[model samples]
Target: MMYTVIDIETTGQGNKITEIAIFKFDGEKVIDEFTSLVNPETYIPEYITALTGIDNSMVAEAPTFREIASSILEITKDCVFVAHNVNFDYNIIRNEFKAIGLEFTRKKLCTIRLSRKLIPGHRSYSLGKLCAALNIPIEGRHRARGDAQATVTLFQRIIDTDNSEKVFAEFLRRTSKEATLPPHLPSDIFNGIPNAPGVYYFKNKKGKIIYIGKAKDLKKRVLGHFYDKTDKELNLCRETADIDYELSGSELIALLMEDAGIKQHYPEYNVASKRNPRAYGIFTYQDRMGINHLAYNILKNAPSPFITFFNITDCRTYLEKICVQFELCPKYCHLQEGVQQCSHYKIHTCRGVCINKESVKNYNLRVEQAISFTSEISSNKIIKKPGRHPDEEGFVLVKNGIYLGFGFVENTEQIINTEDLEHFLIRQKDNVDIQRILKRQLITS
Candidate 1:
C-alpha cells in the first residue's frame, strides 16, 4: 500500500500550519516528496518560533496554505496518511480545509502507536526520543521536512518488523479504535473501560489526574471525548495518557464520586468546581418588638445559620417559600428592603406582622413553627440505590442535612438505621456542589 508520511509545524495558539512536509512511499521506496513553508496569516508565538526556528520573517515570502492546497490534495491522494502523532497532523489539516469550505478525509496511522506494538519496551514513543534511541538521525529536528523524513524511516522500520502485516490489518479494520484514541493511551486500556455507571479520571503521562467526569455509560462517555473536535477536547486528549475509574453502581453515586474525586485531585481540566463557592445562609433573630425575623446573609456573617444555600437567589427563594408557608411578613424576612410594611408582589400571605395588624406574640409563634419546618426538611436521611452487582445494595448517607458519603452493602445484610450504614460508608466532605447534587436526588426521589 502507498503511504504518505507527513508532518506540519503549527502556530501554537491557533494551530495554523506554518510549514508542512510529505514523503510518499510505495512500501519499498520513496517515490515523491513535498515540502513547503507556508505563511500562516497569524502570529507565531515566541516559544513555537524558538522551538521550530520558523519565524514570521522566514515565511513572509512563502506560499499560503490556500495557494498550495491543490498540490497537497494531489500528492496525498489514495495514500494512507502516516505521522508520529497522526491525529494532530490529520485534524489540523482537516480543520484548515474546513476553513476554506472543503472537506478533507483520509485513512491514517500513528507511528507512535505502531512503534509501541512492533518495537515494545521503548522508554518513550515521541518521534525525537524514539528516533534518537534507534540511532535514526533527525537532520532538521523540529522542521517539517526533518520530522516527516524521520517519521518515514520509523514507518519503514515498523513495516519490516516481525508480524507487522497482521498488526497493520488489525489497525486498518473499520471497527478498530487504534487511530481514534490518544497517541499515548493503549487500546487495551481503552477497551477495558466497562459500559457501567462510574467516575472516570483522565491522567497525564506522569499518572497525575487532569480531569474527572461521571457517566451513566462509562465507555460511551469516554469515547465521546475522542470524537469531540473542540480545541479544549483536542488539547485534553493530547495530554491524556491513562484512565482510571471507580464503579458507583448508579448515576447518583457516580455523581457523588465524581464530585469527591475532582475536589480531592483538583484536576487541571475540572474548572467549574475547583473554586470554593461562596455560601449564603438563612438565619433568624428577634426585633426590638420581640417579633421573630428571618434574614439571609453571607455564610461567614450569618453565625449559626438555620439553613445555607450556594447562591443568594436560592437563599432568597427558600426564605420566600418559608415566609409564605408560615404567613410571615416579607419585610421582616428581608425579601423586601426599605419598606415600612411587607408589600411583596408574589407573597400576600403576610399576617400583618409588618403592619402591626397581627400581635407580636402570635407572629413569633408562627416564626418558630417555620424554623421547625426548616429543620424537618433538612433532617437526616438516607438514599438507597442499585449496587455494582447483583446481591449488593448501595446507599448514600446524610446526617443533620450534610452529605457524609456513599457505600455498598450486601442484600443479605439486615441493615436497619443510619448507624448500621456507618460501617460501609465511604466518608466524603460536604460542599456546595455536593449539596446541589444531593438536593436534586432528594427532589427527584
Candidate 2:
C-alpha cells in the first residue's frame, strides 16, 4: 500500500502552513521525500517560534503556499495521507487549497487512532509523549521533518509486527464509513435514527452535547438537516460526532423530554435552552371582595400558575383573547387599570365587574371558566392521547388537581379506575416547563 506520511508546522493561529515534510512509503521502504518552508504571510508568535524553532525570518525567503500548492498535490496524488492528528493537518491543507479556488479531498489515516488500537493503554496519546514511551528517536522535535520521521518509524513498527497486515485490514474496515462522513462528524451516525417521536442530541467526538431538538418523526427531522444548506447547519453537521436520542411514545412526551434535556444540558446550539425557563406566567388570586383576578407576571417562584409562557407579550395577548372569549371584566382581570369601569365594559365587551354591574360571584365564575383548561384548581381529569401502538391508548393522569404522570393502557380494563391506571403509569416530576407543555397539549386537544 502506498502512503504519504506528512507533518506540518504552522503559525498556530489560523490555517497558515509554514513548513511541511512528506515521506512517501510503499509498505517496506520509502520511495521519495519532500520538505520545505513556506511563507505564511503572517506573523509567527514568539512562543510558536520557540517551540518549532522556525522563525519568521526563515520562511521570509521560502515559497508561499500558493507557489507550491501544485507540487504538494502532485506528490501526494493517489496516496493515502497519513498524519498523527489527521483532521487538523488535512483540514488545514484542504482550506488552504480552497482559498485558491481548488477543491481537495484524499483518503486519510490518523496515526493517533491507529496507535490507540494497536498499542493501547498509554498514559498520553500525544505525538511527543507517544514517541518517547515507545523509545523512538525524534530529532528536531516540533520541526516538520523531525515529527514526520518519528511518525514514519511508528508506522514501520506497526507494519513489522506479525499481525500488522491483519490490523491494517481491520483499521480499513472500521474506518471505511468515516471516509464519507462530514468533516465535523465521526461516522454514519444518521443510520440508526428511528422514524418516531423523540428528542435527539448532537455531540462532538469527546461526547460533549452541543445541540438538542425534538420531533414527531426523528428520522425526518435529522434528514432535514442535510438538505438545509445553511451556514449554521453546515457548521453543526461538521462538528457533530454522533447522534443520541430517546424514543417517546407520544408527541407530548417528546416535547417534555426535549425541554428537560435542553434545560439540563444547556446545549450550545439550542438557543432556547440558554434562556430562563418559563419567562412569564399567567397567575390568579382572589381579590378582597371575593373576585378571582388574573394577571401576567415575570416567572419567579410563582406557585401553581394557570399557564406559563416564554414571552410576556404572548401571555398578555392570550389573556386579552380569553377575556373577550369568556366575556370577563377587564378591570377585575387587571387588563385595564385605575378606573371605575373598563373601556371594554363601556363598549359592552366586558361583563362589568369593574363597577359591580356584574355580581362578584358571577364574574369570578367567568374567570374560572376562561382558564378552566389550564386552571391549577381544575378537577382531576384524564387527557387521552394517541399511543405507541394502535390498540394502546396513552393517557395523562391528573389526580386531585395535581398532574400525577402518564401511561399507556392496553385495554378498557387497564383504565377502569385511577387505582388501576397507576399500575401502568410512568411517574413524572412536576415543574413549570412540564406543566406548560401539558396544559398546552390539553388545551389544544
Candidate 3:
C-alpha cells in the first residue's frame, strides 16, 4: 500500500496553511516527493514565525494554496495519509479544500499512534522527540519538508517493526477509530467510556481538566466532539490527552454533576458557571415601633435572608409580588425608597401601615405570613431518578429550597424524610446556574 507521509506549517490562530510537504512511500521505498511554501493570505503570528522560522517575507513570493492545491491532490491520491499527529495535518487540508468548495477525503494513519503500538515504551511520541531518541536526524525541525522527510523515515521504521502487518491492518480497518481520535488520546481510554448518562472531563497532558460536558450517552457525545470541525472543537480535541467520567444514572443528575465539576475546576474551556454570580437576598428586620419590615440587599449584608435571588430584578419582582399578595407596604419591602408613606403605583395593597392607618401588630402579622408563604413555596423536597445501575436509586436533595446535591442509595435503603437522605446526600453549593438547572427539572417533573 502507498502512504503519503505529510507535515504542515500553519498560522496558529487562523490555522491557515503556510507550508506543506509530502513524501509518497511504496511500502519499502520513497517513490515521490512534493514540498511547497504557500502564502496563507493571513497574518502569521510572531510565535508561529519563531517556531517555524517561516515569516511573511519568506512566503510573500511563494504560491498560494490554490496554486499548489492540484500538486497536493495529485501526489497524495490513493495513498493513506500519514503524519506525526495525523488529524491536525489532515483536518487543516480538509478545511482548506472545503473553503475552495472541494472535498478531500482519505483513509489516514497517525505515526504517533502507530509508534505507541509497535515501538512502545517511549517517554514521548512527538515527531522531534521520537526522532531524537531513534537517532534519526531532522535537517530542519519545524519546516514542512524537513519534518515530513523525518516522518517518512519514522514511517518506514514502523513498517519494519515486528507484527507491523497485523497492527497496520487493525488500524486501517474501516471500523477502527484510530484515525478519528485526537492524536494524544489513547484508543483504550475512549473505548472504555460507557454508553450511559454521565459527566465527562477532558484533560490535557498535565492532567488538568480543560472542559466538562454532560450527555445522556457518554460515548456518543464524546465521539461527536471528534467529528465536529468547528475551530473551537478542533482546538479542544487537539489538546485533550485523557478523559475521566462519573456515571450520573440520569440526565438530571448528569447536569448537576457537570455544573459542579465545571464550578469546582473552573476549566479553561468552560465559559459558563465559572464565575460566582452576585447574590441578592430577601430579609426581614424589626423596627423600634414593634413593626416587622421586609427588605432585600446583597447577601453579605442581608442578615438571615428569608430567600435568595441572583439578580436585583428577580429579587424586587418577588418582593413586589409578596407585598401585593400579603397587603404589605411597598415602602417597607424596599420596593420604593425615600417615601414617607407607601404610595406604590403598582402595589396599592399597603393596608395603610406606612402611615399608621393600620396597627403595627396587624402589619407585623401579615409580614410573618408572607415569610411563611415564601418558606412553603420553597419546601424541602427530593427528586428521585434512575440510579447508575440496577438495584440502586438516584435522588436529588433539596432542603428548605436550597439544592443539597445528588446521591445514590441501594434498593433496600428506605428514605423517609430529608434527614433520612443526609447520609447519602452529596452536598453541593446553590448558585444561579444550579438553580436554573433544577428549575427546569422541577417544572418538567
Candidate 4:
C-alpha cells in the first residue's frame, strides 16, 4: 500500500504546526522524503525550543505551511497518512490545509495505538519513549523530520513483527464489517460506539442497566466486548436486545455513574465491585487510651460517606506501602499500632511512632497525610475541568460539605461564585462512588 508517514512540531499552546515532514513509501521502500520548517506565525514557547531544539528564529525565514500545501498533496496522493499520535498531527495538517481553502482527505492511523496492539507490555509507547526502550536511534526526538524518519523505521519493524493471521484479521476489521459476529446484531454495532472519553451503558432487552463502563476510548472498549472471548460477554451479546448510553463528557463522570448504576441496578451479568457488603474497605487503628478511632473503623457503618477501596487486602497493602515510604507508623495508621515501635521502626522503615518516639501529634498527622479520597471528607471545595464540548462546562462536585456528583455549567461565573454555586451545578448522589470519582479526578489533575 502507498503510505506517507508524517510528523509535526507545533507551537505549544496555540497548537499551530510549525514544521512538517513526510516520507513517501511504496510498501517495501521509501520513494522520497520531504521536510520543512514552517513559520508558525507565533512565539515559540521555551519548552518546545528545549525539546525540539528548533527555535522561532530558525523558522523566521522558512516558508509557511500554506506555501507547501500543493507539494504535500502530491506526495501523499493515493497514500495512507500514518504517524505517532496520528490524529493530532493529521488534524493539524488538515486544519492548516482547510485554512487555505483546500480540502484534505486521507486515511489515518496512529502508530502509538498500533504499537501497543502489535507489541504489548512496554512501559510506554510514546514515539521517543518507545524508540529509547527498543534501542531505536532517535537523534532529534521532537523535530518533524527526525520523528518522521523514526516512525517510518518503526512502521517497517511493525510490519515484520505482525503475525499474518492477526494482521489480516485486524486489517479486515478496519476495512469491513466482521462476518463471524452474530447475525442478530447490526452490521454497525462497531460503528455505534463513539471515540469520546465518557461513560457507556449497555442495556439489555428488559431496558435494564446490564453493564455500565468507562473508557478513555469509549468506542474501543464497547467494541472490545463483542470481540472478547470471555464466556460471559458472549452470553450477554447473544441476549442483548438493544443498547443505550449517556455521554458523560468525562471518564470521571462515567466512572462515578458506572459504580452508582451497578449498585442501583444489579444486572444479572455484572458482578465486580458491586456495592455488596464488600463494596468499600478501610484501615482502622486504636489510640493510646484504647479508643477505636472512628476514622479507622471504615465500613458501611462508618459515618463519613467516603468510598475508598475494593477489598481490605488492597487497602492494607496500599497503606502499608505508603507508611513505609513516608515513615508513617503502621501503628498510628491502624495497620500495626501496638506496644513498641512496629516492626518497620525496628527495621528503620518507620520513625518509631509505634514506640512513642515520635509524638502522637506528629504520628497522627502522618496517618492523616497517608489518607486519600477523603478530600470530600475534609475540604469543601468544587472541582473544575475542561468541558467535553466547546459550548459546555465540565465539573465534579463537593458541595454543602457532601460529595455531590458531576455535571456541566454554561458560564464561568457560576463556578467562580461560591455561596450560589452549588445551586447551579448538576447535582448527583453524594454516594461513595461519586466520592471515589472526585478523589481520583483530583489526584489526576
Which residue pairs in candidate 4 collide? 285-334, 331-336, 331-337, 341-355
Off by over 4 Å in 4: 1-175, 180-182, 203-211, 260-268, 271-275, 279-310, 317-327, 334-381, 390-393, 410-414, 418-420, 430-445
Question: How do the residues 1-445 of candidate 2 rate in per-residue lDDT, one tens digit apiece?
Answer: 7999999989877648999999999977889999999899999999899988889899999999899999889889998888886766777788789888888878887777667556777766678899999999999899999999999999887677677677667656644543333444433467688898878998986789988989999978876765454446655665676789987767887776787788788887877644545577778888778888888777785457767676556666667777777887777667778877788533357756777678888888878787775563345777777776677777788876567777777855534677888898888766666666755654445
Q: Estimate each model's TM-score.
A: 0.81, 0.57, 0.78, 0.46
Tell me how many residue pairs clash in candidate 4. 4
Whole-model alpha-carbon lDDT for candidate 1: 0.89
Q: Write the per-residue lDDT of candidate 4 for residues 133-153, one digit (tens) a residue.
A: 878887677888888988888
300 in model 1: Cα distance from truth in Å?
11
Q: How should the candidates be ordered by TM-score, best one leading? A: 1, 3, 2, 4
Candidate 4, residue 121: CA error in Å?
Answer: 46
Taking the tens digit of each residue's C-alpha lDDT, what string does model 3 give over 109-157? Answer: 9999899889998888888889999999999999999999999899989
RMSD of each: 4.5, 8.1, 6.8, 21.3
Name the Cα RMSD for model 1. Answer: 4.5
Cα lDDT tens digits for candidate 1, 1-445: 9999999999998899999999999888899999999999988889999999999999898898889999999999999999988888999999999988888988889999999999999888988899999999999999999999888888999999999999998888889899999989988899999999999999999999999999999999999999887778888988989999989999999999988887788898888744777887889887778877899899999968977777777778788887887888999899999999878899999878777799999998998999887777677877889999988999998888878999999999888877888999999898878887775564345
* True lDDT of residue 120, candidate 2: 72
On TM-score, the leading prediction is: 1
